[model samples]
Target: RANRDHAAGCVTPVISQNSLISSIAQNVLSINPFQQMINEIIKQKIAPLETRMQQLEEMVQDLQERNDCLNYKTNDLAQYQRRCAFHIYGIAENKEGNKNAIIKYIGKVMGVKVEDSDIYASHRLKQNKQGDDC
Candidate 1:
């Protein structure tokens, strides 16, 4: 039937140009205010969360930097403490060499009495390029 109507050139209820424009305008008017309100609400909710996230990131970065600095300081202090410990050089090595004898010899040279108890540990270091004793 519709095909017969088109073939007979009958006029359908064609929407006019004014009708199309009015429909589009009504849709925009109905949706625009609601869309704007939703957008404003979303911005209000997200702004504080974004600010808090940025602050937390900054705090984490600061903590990481402080931890790195502490690690470096600890390493430096450990090296300095090791430096305070003694290393006896140019001493002759003997199979019978012991901690007591070594401490006594060192004390006599340094004009101080060194007992075995005062020595925390004693060992012979491997000879390097200079073949020093420890």
Candidate 2:
């Protein structure tokens, strides 16, 4: 049997060009335009986004607080629909129209109270029994 050799005098080449082509076909192109995109984005867009996000978070917190207050008032109103109490005397606010709002808001919830009468309505909660441990 005669062994045919190339001009370079190479031995039997088991791995040919087809195997290299197959390997290249299996891989995908990973194109990265910038080496420091994340840093640049943080410097450019992220600061504003973080500031706005902080503002949004603060607004959400304010809304939640106002919502809790409104919920409490709404529940109290639902409990007593027929009559309402207006507590006007205690710590009268210096603001002109704020007093009216407070009076009206309170009146819609409870029965009704005058602007000057000192009527005490205390809420006694059920105390939890102390355990023997402490």
Candidate 3:
């Protein structure tokens, strides 16, 4: 500290980085006004990021469920068996759509309703044709 001549006044004061860091740490530790303002801004900014992460997780789960259903559909039934003419007692090329449509028809014939063909087609009777030998 430099003393001024005559009236005994001080000269310009010097500031240090260490004192600045100490003051900031104290303010944050003590819940001062500046710390409160910073906390509010950080919370508001992070909230949207949290919401988007939740949405992305839900989308991945849905995709996984759909993939499992598709795998069951392909594995459960053969192409030829999926398309046998019940009324004619003969085999024919079946449309992927045709195989799906007959499930509803047979379900109605037996007084039942099927919602998921992937689940229904796994059954032997449903995937194959009616045979007099059996």
**Candidate 1 — worst ten consecutive residues by lDDT sum?**
7-16
**Model 1: which residue pairs collide?**
none
Clashing pairs in 3: none
Candidate 2 vs 3: which has more lDDT: 3
- Find the 10 residues in a row with the least total lDDT in model 2: 116-125
* Positional deviation of residue 122's Cα in model 3 after best superposition, in angstroms: 25
Candidate number with greatest TM-score: 1
| All models, RMSD in angstroms | 6.4, 16.6, 14.2
TM-score result, candidate 2: 0.33
Per-model lDDT: 0.83, 0.58, 0.64
TM-score against truth, every candidate: 0.63, 0.33, 0.37
The predicted structure with the larger TM-score, 1 or 3, is 1
Candidate 3 error regions (>4 Å): 1-31, 78-134
Q: Which tens-of-lDDT digit does each residue in 8-77 have in candidate 1? A: 5643334465678899999999898989999999999999999999999999999999999999999999
